[model samples]
Target: MEFSWLNWLYTAIAQVITWIHQAYSTFITPSSGLNWVLTIVTLTVLMRILIFPLFLKQMRSSKKMQELAPKVQELRKRYKDDKQRLNQEVMALYQGAGANPLGGCLPILAQFPIFISMFTVLNAIADPKRVSVFGMPADVVASAREAHIFSAGISDHFFSTQSVTSKIIIGFFVATSSLTTFLTVRQSVTRSIEQMPDNPMAQQQKILMYISPLFAFFSLNFPLGLILYWVTTNLWTLGQQHWYYSRHPMPKFDERGRLIPVEPKPGLLAKLRKSEPAPAEEPPPAKPEPKVVRNQPTRQPRSKRTGSKKS
Candidate 1:
C-alpha cells in the first residue's frame, strides 16, 4: 500500500506524541488525567523548541520590518497620489533591504499542519470506533481513548461531553487559550505601533486583536485535549514574547510618530566599568638631553676653509 507524504508527517507527529505519552504514563501514572495533560503541554514545548530557529527568523524579519517602517512611510508619502507607483517602490525597497513584510507568518503557518494532525490524532484516539492512522497501534489508540482528565475523557468537548465537570474544564481551557491569543496579538500590535506609530498595518492589527478572542466560540466544538494544547502553546508564546522583548526591545515612537530613543539598561560590561575606578593619569616623562658623541668628527673652522680656498 502506498502512503502519501501527509501520512508520513502524521506518523512522525504521532510517534512524538506517543513517546511523550508513554514517558509521562510511565513516570507519572499509567492512567492519570494530569499525565495526559502534561504530555500535551510537553508536546507543545517540544514543538516550540523544534521551531525555535523559525521563531528567531521571524523575530529578525519583524525587526527588519520595524526598522523599515520609516522608509516605508517615506515611500507612502512620496507617491501618495500614485498608488501603483508607491506599491512598486515599496516592493523595491523591501527587496533591496531583504525584508519580507510577511516573513513572521511563516512559523505560524508551518505550525498549522502539525496542529491539525495532532488534533486529528487525538480525536481518533478518543473515538474507539475511528480507525487508527499515522502508524499508531490499535492498543495504544484504545489506551488513549480511555485516558481521562478530571473524570472527563481527554476527547470530551463542551458540546459532546455529557458531564458538567468536563464542560466546565473545556470551557476554561478555551477561554484561557483565546484570552492569551488576544493578549499576544495585542502586545505584538502595540509594539508594532511603538516601532512605527503611523504603521499602515496598525488598523488591521486592531481588527485582529478584537476578532481573536471570538475564536473561543469556535473552539467550543474542539476536543478538550486540543484545547489544552492550544492554551499551553498560547501561554508559551506570551512568555516567550515577554522574555524576548525584555532583551531586544522594539523602537519606541511617540504620538507624533517620531522615534523615541530609550535609555538602555546597564549591561554586565557597563556595570563592571562603572564599578572600577579610573586609572591615575601618568605624568609626562622629561625629555632626554641629546647626547654628543665624544669622538665624532667636527666640522672644519669656516676661516681655515676660506684661507685654503684663497691659497
Candidate 2:
C-alpha cells in the first residue's frame, strides 16, 4: 500500500478525536451527543493552541510590515530610479525587522492541511455505511455515527435531514461560523486601510470581507460534525483576534487615508532628563587679550627724504 500523507494526517486527527472522546466519555455518557460535541470542541481547542505560534508569527510579521511601511515608502521615493538598489534596501529593512513577506501567510498555509484532514476524517466517520476511511479504526467511525447534537445526527446535513430541529441546530452553527468569519475579514480590511490605504490588494480584501459569510452557506451540504468543528474554530479565531487587537490596537487612519502617528510615552531616559534640574549655565569664556599697536615714525617730505633715493 502506498504511504499517503493526507491519509496519515486524517488518521492522526481521528486518533486524537477518539482519545478525547474516550476521556470525555468517562463521566459523560459514552454514547451521548453532548460528549461527542464536547470532544470536537476540545479537539479544535487543542489544534488552535498548537497552531498559535504560527498565528503569532503571522501577526508579528504583519505588524512589522505595517511599522516599516513609511520607511518602505521613503525608500521607494529615495531610490525610485534604482530598482535593484530599492529591492536591496527593502530586503535589508525586512531583514532588520526580522519580518518576511511570506511570514503573514504561514498561519493560513498551516491551517489548510489540518482543516482538510479534520474535514475528511469527520466526513468519513459521519457516513452511516462507511468502509475503510483514512485508516481510522472501524469502532471509532461506528461510534461517531451514533452521536447527535440537539436531536440531529452528527452526520446530518441541513439539506439532507428532514427534521426541522436538525435544520435549526445546523443552521445556527452555519450562521455563527459564517458571521465570525465575516467579522474577522472585516476587521482585517479595516486595519489594511490604515496600514496601507493605497494598497491595490485592499480592494480584494474588501471583496472577501463581504463575501466570506456567503461561503458559510455551503455548510448546508457539510456534515454537522464538521460544521460544529468549524464553528468552534471560527469562534476561537474571532476571540483571539479580538483579544490581540484590544491590547495592541492597530493605528487609525485619517479621512484622507493617511496613518495617524501615535504619540509614544516618554521613555526612562526621557523621563530622567525631564525630571533632573537643568545644568548651571557656564560663565562666558574670558575674552582674548587685546593686541598692542606699535606706532610708526612720521616720514619727512619726499624732497627731504630724497637724500637716500636711487638715481
Candidate 3:
C-alpha cells in the first residue's frame, strides 16, 4: 500500500489532538463547557508557542528596519529623480546594514500554510460523526459541531434559527475583532510616522497605515476561531512592539550613517561653574643681585678723592 503524504500529515495532527485530549481527560476534572473553552485556549497557546521563533525574527527585522530608516531616507533624497538608482541604493543600504525589509513579512507568510492546516483539523474534529479514538466525548464533539468556529451563531442556524443571545454573542466577537485590528494597525501607523522620511514614500506608508485597519474590519465575519487567533496574535504584536520601543528607543543617525550622540543637559552646579574663570598660577619671585658690586664701588671713591686734591 502506497503511503500518501497528505494522509500522513493528517494522521500526525490527529495523534497530537489525541494526546491533548488524553492529557485534559487525565488532569482536568469534569470536562464541561468551560473545559472545552480552556482546551481551545490551550490549543491556541500551543500554536503561538510553535510560531514564537518566527515572531521574534519578525520583531528583530522590524527593529533593524527602524534603525535603517534614516540612511534609507538619505538615499531616497539623493536619488529622488532616478527610480532605478533609488532601488539600487535601497538594496545596497539593506545589504550594508545586514537588514532585509521583507524579513518581517517572511515569517508571517511562512505561517499561512500551517494556519490553514490547523483550521482544517479543528473543523474536522468539531464534526459530531467523525471517528473518535482519543476519548473525545460524543456530546462534546456534537457541541463543537453546533459551535460556529468563525461566527457566534450555531452552525445549525445557517439559514433560519434565530436567538437574541446568539446574535449578541456574535456581535460581541465581531466588535472585539474589529476593535483589536484597528488598535493594532493604529499603533503600527504611529510608529511608522515617527520613523518615516519626509518624502512621497512616507506619505504613502502613512496613508496605508490608516487605510489597512478599515480593511481589517471587513474580516470580522470570518470564523470566530480565526478571529480569536488573530486577536491573540495582534495583542502579542502590540505588546512586543511597545516593549521594543520603550527599551530600545530608535537611535538618531546622520547623513553619513554615524549615530549622533545626544548631549547631556548641564545640571545646576555645572551651569553655575561654567560662568567662573579658572584661577591662574602666580610666577616665582626674582633672585637678588650678587655682592661682587662692592669692589667696583671702593675703586670709584678713591678716584673721586684724588681728583678733589688736584683741584
Best by TM-score: 1
Best by lDDT: 2
User: How accurate locally is residue 76 in candidate 1, as Cα lDDT from 0 to 100?
Assistant: 86
- Which residue pairs clash in candidate 3? 149-224, 150-223, 150-224
lDDT by residue for model 3 over 1-311, one digit each (tens)? 11355555545554665466456756654234344445556665676678778767766767677777777877878988999999998888777877766776765785575555545555555444675523445544554444443344332221222655655555565567667767777776676666664545666766776676676555434444554555666676677666556655655777677776545445556878997897787888878777674444444665576777533
Candidate 1 RMSD to the real structure: 10.3
Per-residue lDDT value at 35 in model 1: 76
Put down candidate 2 lDDT per residue, 85-144, tens digits, no spaces: 998999999999998878857777877777787767766766667765666566666667
Assess candidate 1 and give its TM-score to the true structure: 0.78
Q: Candidate 1, overall lDDT?
A: 0.79
Task: Quote the lDDT for 77 in model 1.
Answer: 85
Clashes of 1: 0
Residue 131 displacement in candidate 2 (angstroms):
6.5
Q: Is candidate 2 or candidate 3 better by TM-score?
A: 2
Where does model 1 exceed 4 Å of error?
Answer: 1-5, 130-133, 252-311
Q: Each prediction's Cα lDDT score?
A: 0.79, 0.80, 0.59
Q: Per-candidate TM vs. native?
A: 0.78, 0.73, 0.66
